[model samples]
Target: MRVISFINMKGGVGKTTLSTNVAHCLAVHEKKKVLLIDIDPQFNATQCFFSGDDYVKYMEDGSDTVLDLFDGDVTRVSTVRGASHKSKKCYEEIKPYKIMDNLYILPGNLNLFKIEISAGSGKENRLKKYLDVVQQLLGFDYVIIDTPPTPSIWMTSALVASNYYVIPVKPDPLSYTGVSLLQTIIDQKKEDLDLQLKFLGIILTMVEESTLVYKRCVETIKSTDNLKDYLFGNFIHKRTEIPKQQLSQSFILDLEKSELSYNLVAIIKEMIKRIERYEEHK
Candidate 1:
């Protein structure tokens, strides 16, 4: 499976929105089996898939979540021993919720914040190890992980487990700073973990073309060598319909023909091409 993470060092840059919409587009339009893993403790991505009442029910029932994979009781064993190993056991235990025909989500929990604090040093590799089993059993075409805004064990684990990552940057100076910080973090993790993680691209979200700040940011991105090469050609413009549809629990693909839907479709196409290029080079 192609594992990708939508990440940013700053919050409210539309990370969850981008991740959810991309997964929806892949599953609904491309006929690909997509698995969305909500690693963010905020559980915003999980909320996107469920209603308020349903979310409460899911939390109250102690349904299987990402927390189950991180708990101390879950241990990993070699797959060479066949189907009776710990990996398969854990995989069977955590049942991902099916949202659509080809879309599933490994829900997130609020308790993840607490679990992350007390987590051991070995926790960084836990997500990677668990996904190994998941790819074998579930066989998804794409796995998109949504991470917290700030750097933490969860973010590190997500990066360690992903084949590629996309940074969702808002059209602002501060968001540019976040891009720099995230780039450094990714570089450090790649060297530390000996990972072959590729930079898919930086997507500009919530863009307002009329604003001077937006123009300046775009100019800077074009002028800067490092940022220019990695910035996606298509940007997501701010639209009221996005939040309206999200509040109504509507998928991007299900929305009426509008600018938001068009942008989402374009972004997903670009993402697919980038992934294909990475696979080719690899």
Candidate 2:
């Protein structure tokens, strides 16, 4: 299975949108089993798949979430050391919520942010270990992890468990500045952890084609030596329909035929091809 994380050092860059839509496209169009893990403490991805009432109920019921795995790991270690016999089993099989026939989501919770602080040493690898168990017990063709905008323990865990990372950038100067920050983290992690993660590509999102600033921003990004090759050929344009569909909790594929949906489909197809090519070379 291939694991990919959608991340950025800046917020409001549409990382969640890309992650959710890409997973939806792969599952609905390619007929692949896709698991989307929401690592963002804001629970944006989780909200995407459920309504306000449903989400409240899901949270109130204490559904299995990313926090479960992290907290479970700590308990498992304490139990092994004979610290607590009442420690809960860490490797319980977590059944993801089936959003579609082949699409599932391991929802995220706000408590994850707090859990990170109380986590034990070597907790950065907790996500990777949990995914190892998940892959063994319940297989999937692809795993898409959506990370928070800031650099945090949650983001680190996602990066450690990812095979590739995709950065979504807005057509603006501040967002462009975040690219360097992200690259530095990736470079350091690759050496320190000996991770085999690859850069899937930087996708320009929320673009307004008619604006001069948009054109200038695109030019600057494409001309930058470090970012040129990593920039995606196609960009996702800013569309009113996107927010409408999102507020209604509708999948990109299920939306009516439109420019945004068409571009999303194209981007996903390109992503699949890129992954395939990477696998071939590997």
Pairs with backbone N, CA or C atoms under 3 Å apart (clashes), candidate 2: none
- TM-score list, all predictions: 0.91, 0.91
Residue-wise C-alpha lDDT for candidate 1, range 1-282, written one tens digit per residue: 999999998998989988998998899988999999999999999888999889878765656788877775434232333322123236556778899899999999876876644334786787888788877788899999999998888988899999999999899999876677678888988888788999999999999989999899888877877678888888888888778878877876786687777878888889889889878876
Error of 1 at 215 (Å): 1.4
- Global Cα lDDT for candidate 2: 0.82
TM-score for predicted model 2 compared with the true structure: 0.91
Clashes of 2: 0
Model 2, 71-164: lDDT tens digits are 6434212222444322334755666788879899999877676664532378788789878888887788999999998778888889899999
lDDT of each: 0.84, 0.82
RMSD of each: 6.3, 4.9
Clashing pairs in 1: none
Off by over 4 Å in 2: 72-89, 118-120
Give the residue spans of candidate 1 off by over 4 A: 73-89, 117-120
